[model samples]
Target: MTPSPGRSYPILISVILVGLVALALGTQPIKPIMSNWPAALNIAAPDVLALPTAAPPAAISGAALITGVAQAQGEGETALEVYMAQSDVQEDVGEGQVRFTRRDVAGGALELLVLRLDEHTNIRVINADGATPGSDERGDTTWTDGQRHLRTVQEMTTAPYALRENSELLGAIAFGFHGEPRTANEGTVVIDGQVLRSNPGRATLCITHERRAEIGRFSSEDLARCAQAIGGGPVLLWDTLIANPDVATAEGEFLPFNPLGEDFVQLDWRKKIYNGRYPKTAAGIGLLESGESFLVLATSYDMTGIDLARQLRDMGCYAALGGDDDTSTQTVWRGQLTRARDVRPVPAAIGVYVRTQ
Candidate 1:
């Protein structure tokens, strides 16, 4: 459409006057709407696997990992350096009742799910067969010589294996995590107020009838406080600090089949087994703005027991103990696998549920 010259001149003059008025008013230019990332929400990147490093020394085999004992302890390798964000994704998934955070750490990520310990939520220890394994932990603390033998029990499974068998847990979990026992059962396990196995000084997860949770060494004084408990050692976090930074000190061997025919050999596989930013999990309790809360944490990639403790402290945890690491590290949040798929079948788990309010 062509404007007449007389009308165009008036329009130009009006535009000029508006421009001068805008300049005097200090009007700012509109920012461009970016079709791509420059819109600047600057959201944290998604989780990723750690970069490849030299192949770490492999444990002899899967069966070897399941049954081999450590003859001599090896020094832990210096961990790969990383920078975890002070805070990352903290979306409250189940209204304000449950929250999950996946904080970025270097190239990988760590996950934390905090469930409010309010009147609406409840927690319990779920064993695979609804019974604690009827096996006693018998073997040497260390085998100085290989020519000895002590028959022991082997009852290990994946997280999903334990999670699926319990019908009570299927539809009720707000969040759940694999309980301590990994290669072989260590520490203490108490189910339904009955002590299935009792050994003091292992990192223990204790839940009282009141829904209060505790993580620390299993001891006599602590026994009565726990209606349910699961033992995973080296206790990594306590009193809100990195408590046991040296959980890598291998405890002993797990050879149930007695392949070498010696009863057992002492081995510390923590440092070597959970190598270089491999995923790890833990159960803990922390004080938040709401009050003390239950915590189930995992690293998507790149963390050890010590690293996990540091992160938990940063996330407001007062105390915690290690869960199984590597593939044994698994979590379920509101019926979703926090990891991609269930690669392992565990024998036991801690399940949290919402009460029928």
Candidate 2:
């Protein structure tokens, strides 16, 4: 059964040095959990979680990033968050735990949260209600229209799925219910072996019950064994090539936008999101110096799928997929959420969490 988020972790030592400086200069040290995280995710609560950043990456374009620009920086927007497109910026949240990276492009900015996959770190798929996956017809009307169910991402990660220290969210871009009614989530969603929804044939991200990660067009047997899995795609970056990223749904339709969002959000249900520029988010595995790791990215401003794929490829991602474009793109890391326009509550998400065992 899914429970609500009702827990908090004690302060860790990584930020203590910064905290000491805060104490010395009479300034408040930055904490792992942000106070307004829950509110940012549209969750009604006293406490919250996060979405963090790292160093600014190589500029993808020639846009001058001069001013600080951030929609909801922690405690509020630091000047850096405001005009980040001017230069690349990143921060070390936990020395050996979760690493945050931020990069700026001409018309947009990208934030990446990296969590090493060891015995202690892992990933999971969350559904707003314990039972319904966003793609399923049984529920999650919030994505198709208004939030008639009143569920939040917080509820999606409650109780049996509560997080420990150092956790981050990856946008899978479950799907925006606009355009043709036939266009919906392309694949299936399976949590702990219980199939929440199913479309079967499509690109899939599978995390074994034992927590091994794999991405491919899996067979029925492969998907059934998955402990946590989310399937849908117009693959963003696959095998070093820009995979099929032009389609939005199983029907091969064009950008199917969320009506709640602006009409010019620049989204394509099919391949158009990749072809056009708009706020985007992506999730995939990266080949880091240490080993294979999971990475999530969010961008404010505007960017194309090609640029996003190149950026992920630049970051060493062997494979990646666009989560969704425009306001459907949101993330939470260390109690912080990425800044974007048309921020809407998502019914499904793939999150990185700390293992209690």
**Best candidate, lDDT-wise?**
2
lDDT measured at residue 102 in model 2 versus the true structure, 0 to 100? 67
lDDT of 1 by residue, 205-276 (tens): 676666666654344344565677776644454443343323232223211121111111122355444344
Q: Write the per-residue lDDT of candidate 2 for residues 1-357, one digit (tens) a residue.
A: 654444222335547777787788775542211111122223222121121122121211111110111111121112222333333445543453455566777776677665555556666665544334333233321233323332234344443444435544422223322222322233456766875544322345666665545555443444666777775444565444444333222122112222111112223444466567766666655533433444444443477776776665555555565555566666555444545334665556666665443
TM-scores of all candidate predictions against the true structure: 0.54, 0.56
Model 2 TM-score? 0.56
lDDT (C-alpha) at residue 264 in model 2: 22
Name the regions of candidate 2 deviating beyond 4 angstroms.
1-96, 134-186, 244-269, 288-291, 297-300
In Å, residue 261's CA in model 2 sits off its true spot by: 28
Q: Which candidate is the best by TM-score?
A: 2
The 10 consecutive residues of candidate 2 with the worst lDDT sum are: 64-73
